[model samples]
Target: MKTEEHKMKKERWEKDMMLEHRRIEMEEQRLQWEQEQEIMFCDVTTMDDDQRAYVLAKRAKIAKAMSASVGETASGESGV
Candidate 1:
C-alpha cells in the first residue's frame, strides 16, 4: 500500500540521517585527536639534549598524573 511504502521510506531516511550524523561526529573527534597529537608531539627533534630531556620528563609526569586520575575515577574515588 502507499501508506506502508511511505512509512518505509521515512524509516530509511531517518536511518540515513542517523548514519550521517554519526559520521560527522566521528570526523570531528578524529580532528580533535589529531590536534591533540600535534600539540603533544611538536618538533622535538629540533631541541637540544637538555631541552629534550626536560620535555620528556614533563610528558612523563603528565602521563603519570593522568593515569592516576583515571585509576581513581575508575575505582569511584575520584576525590572531585
Candidate 2:
C-alpha cells in the first residue's frame, strides 16, 4: 500500500539522518584527538635522535596511563 511505503520511506530517512549525525560527531572527535595530541608533546629543537625518541616515548607512556584510568576517576568526579 502507498501508506506503508510512505512510512517505510520516512523510517529510512530518519535512519539515514541519524547515521549522518553520528558521522559528523565522529569527525569532530577525531579533530579533537589530533589537537590534544599536538598539545601533549612539546617540541624539542636540536635534540639528538636518541634523546628525542626517549622524550617522545615517555610522553606517550604518560598519555597511555591517563587513558587507561578513564572509567574510574572521570565518572566518579562527574557524579559527585
Residue pairs with backbone overlap in model 1:
none
Local error of candidate 1 at residue 36 (angstroms):
0.4
Error of 1 at 14 (Å): 0.2
Q: Write the per-residue lDDT of candidate 2 for residues 1-80, one digit (tens) a residue.
A: 99999999999999999999999999997996776576466685767898788777777875776676675577665311
lDDT (Cα atoms) of all candidates against the true structure: 0.81, 0.76
lDDT of 1 by residue, 1-80 (tens): 99999999999999999999999999997996675566468778999998888777767775776689799999999643
By TM-score, how accurate is candidate 1?
0.56
Query: How many times do residue backbones clash in model 2?
Result: 0
Distance from true location, Cα of 41 in model 2, Å = 1.2
Error of model 1, residue 28, in angstroms: 0.4
Candidate 2: stretches off by over 4 Å: 44-69, 72-80
Query: What is the TM-score (0 to 1) of candidate 2?
Result: 0.56
lDDT of 2 at 24: 95
